[model samples]
Target: MMIEAAAKMAQWLRLEDGFTLIAHTSPDGDTIGSSLAMFYILTCMGKRVQVVCEHIVPYLYSFLPYAEAFNTPDTAEKSYKNAIAIDCADKNRMGKAVGIYNASMLTGSIDHHKTNTAYGDYVLHDENASATGELVFHLWQHLGVAVEKSKTALDIACSLFTAISTDTGNFSYCNATPGSFRAAAALVEYGIDIAEINRLVYRTLPIGKTRLIGYVLSSMRLYNDARIGAAILLWEDFLRFGAIPEDVEGIIDYIRDVDSIEIAMILRQTQKGDFKVSMRSKRYADVSAIAGRFGGGGHLRAAGCTMQGQPEAILEQLLQVSTDALGQ
Candidate 1:
């Protein structure tokens, strides 16, 4: 069903022009990579395409081909013939680009999240897909953008590789499937420097990030008899390290790696005094349901939510829900 949807959407996109590709807010590798892959494909075909996201492309992804091409919604033109959302499960995730999506004559969505709301005029979702990049690879094939012949194939391959590699934790996560490895193999055949990409994304972190991670971990708390680990980074913590939100990106992974920890969570305070919580589960817990309680959601193992409250109070609320989920 997802393949059929992708084929139909590819046909529609082939006939469309003046497209705006929207990525989700606080965009991750999957969102940025998938969106850029579509941008390159459409641009190579002589279609006018603009990629928009609420936040700047993080410095970690700056090395991606055409990373600088991403535009803030405010800088985009007022109108587009069509809008396609990549890697976003819900319309709200479009963030500021929701305006562009709403203004377009037609709208579509492509995503791999199992918790997706199926919101959009044309929606293609594959819960089993390792990453949205995996689906985008098939979409490109359907659109007849022959990887071997297209001049832009390298850029598309790099973007897709970043999307797949990061979302799967460098293929270490359980989400990494046989299809993912196969897609990655195809992308590597395009001559992307895998080592360089890995260096830039994982090994090259700013000193601020190092300090921030140390602080976050040092102050972490264990709950429910060590079944859950939680950490919070206040705005002051970011200020101290001179770190941005992106710097906190993978901090929860460290917590999740601890033995006997079934669930791990990290909360960061936003400028608006709201808390953005990211949750990860090793096996049993469904963090998506916890996130959905606050009108946010993502995959079962990883999910997030935004809420307004004092830090301690929010932690208490989250702990209660998490404890209940763990049947503790």
Candidate 2:
């Protein structure tokens, strides 16, 4: 069935000379790696490929293969053909590429997020997959596309490896099963520097991010009798510390560690006055279901939603919803 989908997408690709691959709006390693891997694959097949995302690849991850080959919507506005969305659960998360996808001749989606809405014309979404890279790998295998397994040509493997490694929390999350490890080990055989990957991902953070985190930790809140940890970051907090969107990436994990905490929620006030919420769960809680109620979604253990209101009001509403989910 997956092969049939890939074959159909490949046929659609044959109708056009070029295509655009859109990662999620705010890209992480999985999104970036999946997009670049697809870009490289399509380009090698003599299909012109462009990777379009809102932000540039972060400095630390710029060393990924073919990182230099991305194009912005502004750059490829007139020339692109099909639209392929990767690591994105929904079309709105496509960000700058959303308009292009709507106007494109063909649209295909590839993702591994469990909460995916199946938005594209050709969607290959597998929640069991640790990352979109794994889906791409399986799809490639099914389609009978031959990739040289040489150490020197490990671009796709490395990309998939990074995607799996990051989305599964370095393969420590519950989603990292036997198949996940097998896929990762296969990538290692392609000569990925596993040690370097760990160092680069875990040990690297901007100085500004450190200070921003310090502020959040100092003012943390514990709710539901400390069984649920919560935190609030007003726009003023970020302004005082020079924090950006990416700096607040892993703060939810901090709250998830509280003893007996079934759920954790982090609410941050974006500069635009909208509230951005991040959530994590310890066990037996389906945070993605709650997030879906608010028009956002992610993995089972972690999810997020955005709302239009002050942080306090939004937090009150989500607390009620999250508390209800804890009982379920």
Maximum-lDDT candidate: 1
Model 1: which ten-residue window has the lowest total lDDT? 142-151
Candidate 1 CA-lDDT value: 0.90
lDDT of 2 by residue, 1-328 (tens): 2667777766675566778898776678899988887776776677777888876777767878877766666776555768888988888888877888988877889988778898878888878888888887676555444567654248887787888888898999888988889888877887878888888878777877888777777777777777677888888877788778768988777678767688988888888888888889987889999899999999998899899886778878888888788784
The sequence of per-residue lDDT tens digits that candidate 1 reaches over residues 186-249 is 8999888899889988799788999998987899999999999999899988998999887898
Deviation from truth (RMSD, Å), model 2: 4.9
Superposed model 2: Cα runs more than 4 Å off = 10-16, 113-121, 143-152, 214-242, 260-328
* Per-prediction backbone clash count: 0, 0
Error of 1 at 33 (Å): 0.7
